[model samples]
Target: MKEKHTWLDAVWRILLYFWALTIVFPLCWVLYESLKTNPEFYQDIWALPKQLNWQNYADAWTDYGFGKSLLNTLYYVGGTLIVSLFFTTINAYALTRMEFKGRNLIWGLIMLSLFLPGVNALVPQYVVMRELGLTNSIPGLILLSGLGESVFYLMLLGGFMRSLPKELEESAIMDGASLFQKFWRVIVPLSTPGIVTVAVFKFLGYYNNFMGPFIYLSDPEKYPIAVQMYSANKQMEYTADWVTLFAGVAISMVPSIIIYMLFQRLLMEGATMGAVKG
Candidate 1:
């Protein structure tokens, strides 16, 4: 059934649209500001630029080392996503479907850890990284992110996995499929929506991560786009070349925006189904 229309509903819609504009207008302003010169920006912040200058993006790319930072960010994000998602997928399946001793207890323990503040673990993480000789390196950062795993992803996927029918696993079992084979062939494929949801989130977290790179990485060149953008903004303050700084901010925003746009449907589905089923 369609949702009933009412004056309150109409008013709510209008309020939501107004709220949306509040967020979008700033992004629009920043995008246009990135095309203006320093003088033009100061003269009239809201006015359109007389000319489109692609040079801000170029300067942001080269002068700010965004190119290198982008590669490093991708490396960290991709590597962490691959490793974390792999374990999250299998673990979610096991906890949700496969009967095992202490399964619920393990899930409870994992969820319980989420209540503990992440900040408290920083010193121990650093010490462990130092002992393992993984500090100040991209791979080290990747490992750090992938380590401990994410209780959120596990929970989200476990919820989604519960919604899947047991018949698929039973059919695979009748075919003499082993545990790994059943999971690889049957479970993983059906779980794509939930997996995509997890991937999209992990991408955003890794892309915009500042604390991890800032703490673990001493090398400026190894900094991810988030940290690099911060450094670029700080340097640009002296020059007052606000356009390029805005360009860097715009660049950093692009991936998360793009990923969310592409996977929005799956994200909603994963959220809804996970919540309902789990």
Candidate 2:
């Protein structure tokens, strides 16, 4: 019986290692090719570069307009994150702790919407964005992205908040704390893990959001890196400079990777928050 358990563990470990390699290898290949010129790329797709051509990075940054795209992405994502924090936290607090009419019904509707396909709403979303005069505008794009409570974020906080004892709020009340004080002081501080977890997830999503910027933003100057990369991809087809194209792709990947590495711990805590009760 012990031997059976040991063998199963070994098998699982092997599978996990293989999965990790599948992800890591593609990134390594892209980085490798980014250093080579067009001739070198076709000559040996898998070989290392003869010399590191750092100029490819410069061309990707300047010639392709990636510098401008990077700034625009920061503005759009920053606005979305700021607006979302208030809405997600407040909505979770009210639905879980405050007794209000139609609370369950509201939550039920959110849960139901989660199962529906987002692609189905593209036509309606486009029409609404146009009617609001938001198309091709950064502020308009931010507003469209920040609308509605994020179902996953709300659910994560709700589970973690539910596990928290009501006595915390009661104690705050005894000290003459108002409803707003109890929430911002007690609840937000304690629920940091879940908040960070959801934040990392949302950050990655918004950073790599291509479809939103592509459809709504008609102007090339306003495109995020994701959309800009698509345009770069097309240019490479004509220029045949796959090296610089890969460089642009590499630049686009760096931010998300750095952020995930920094806050990965919060994900584990958030995932397990529902199971343990106070």
Candidate 3:
């Protein structure tokens, strides 16, 4: 039994190592490629740089207009976070905690949206934006992104809210707390984990958004990092300045990776807490 267990443990360790490598290797390769000159990259695409070229990042930053793109991405992400979180939390609270006619029917419709592909709504959404004269505006982009209350986030939060003791709200009411106060003081504080998860997901979606900006924003100055990166790649000459392209890609991804690492623990807890309790 001891011998069998030892063999199984060894196999598991090897598999874990392979899994780790599978994830890390691509990131490492990109980092390496970003430091190589165009000639060096073409000469041996897989070879490590003879001398790490730090100037690649500087060139990419200025030439790709990453500075402006970065600012635009921040605005979009921040707007999405504020708008989506507010609506998602309020809607989730109402759906889960308050008694209302047709509440379940509304939830059922929202769940049905989960089955519908986002692409199906593109033409109508575009027409509405055009009719409103908002096709090229940042506010329009933000509104479009925030229009759909994310059912997945709502459901996750609802499950978490359902797991809470009903007496908590009842006690608040007994103390003469208004419905607003009860939700603000008691429910919101307890639902932090779910809120954090929703915020993180929204942040990522807005930050890396390509299709929305691509379709709606025609002004080069207003383009976000993802669209800007594509523009940079498209303008590359026959020689293909890979170093700058890779650097641009790396810079674009840095904010996402940093945000994920910073709030990963909270996200994990929020995602799993409801499941564990349920």
Candidate 4:
């Protein structure tokens, strides 16, 4: 039995290593390509750069307007997180904890919306933004992006909330705590894992969003990192600076990486907790 178990463990370890490599290899290749000259990149696609090209990052930062674009991305991401998290949390709390009429129907509708392709609404969304004179504005983009609570987040947090002891809220209510107080002091604090998970998702989504800004933002100065990267790639014909373009891509990815690394534990806990409970 011990011999059989040892063989199984060895096979599992090899499979796990292969799985990790499948995901990690592409990222490593990108990093390697970012350091190579265009000719070298084409010549040896899988090999490491002969020497690290640190100037690529600096060139990308300055010439590609990534510095300004980074700032704009930070604003959009921060605003989206603030607005989306606020609404999602409140909506989740109400749907899960409070009694209401037609709750199931409302939830069903939200689930249906999740199935609708986002592109289908683009024309209408653009018209509304134009009418509101929100085109090319960061706040407008943030508000439009944060229009509704995602069913996924609502359902995830609802599961976590369900797993909590009802007696906690009941005792607070018996102690003369208002509904707002209970939410603010008791539930919100306990729901940290769910909140962190939701925030991480929103942050990543907002940071990487390109289409909305591309269609609405006419001014180059107002463009975010993703748009700026697009612009950089396009201008490479006149500029002929592949290094800067790669650098811009690398820079654009950093914030999302940092955020995921920081909140990875919370994200995993929230996702697994919701999945198991639900």
Task: Report the poorest 10 consecutive residues by lDDT, candidate 2.
Answer: 269-278
Q: What is the lDDT of residue 113 in candidate 4?
A: 92
Against the true structure, whose TM-score is highest?
1
- Residue-wise C-alpha lDDT for candidate 1, range 130-224, written one tens digit per residue: 99999999998888898657888888998899889999999999999999999999999999989998888888888888998999999988999
Q: For each candidate in turn, give its C-alpha RMSD to the true structure in angstroms.
A: 1.5, 2.1, 2.2, 2.3
Residue 145 displacement (Å), model 1:
0.4
Clash list (residue pairs), candidate 2 = none
lDDT of every predicted structure (CA atoms): 0.89, 0.87, 0.88, 0.85
For model 3, residues 1-278, the per-residue Cα lDDT tens digits are: 54456788889999999999999998889999999988999899899999999999998888778878888988877886788888888898999999999998999899899999988988999999999999988888988887667788888888888888999999999999999998899999999998888888888878878999999999999998989988898888653788888888888889989989999999999989977764
Query: Under the 3 Å rule for N, CA and C atoms, how many clashes does model 2 have?
Result: 0
Instruction: TM-score each candidate.
Output: 0.95, 0.94, 0.93, 0.91
- State how far residue 3 of model 4 sits from its true place (Å): 11
The parts of candidate 2 lying over 4 Å away from their true place are: 1-5, 274-278
Shift of residue 111 alpha carbon in model 2, Å: 1.5
Please report the candidate that would top lDDT against the real structure: 1
lDDT of 1 at 214: 92
For the record, the alpha-carbon RMSD of candidate 4 to the native fold, in angstroms, is: 2.3
Q: lDDT per residue, candidate 4, 1-278, as tens digits?
A: 54456788889999999999998887777777788787776677778889988788887777779999999989888888898898888888888888889988988898899889888989998999999999989999999988756777888888887777889999999999999999999999999998888888878777878998999999999899989988988898896777557767777878888998999999999889878875
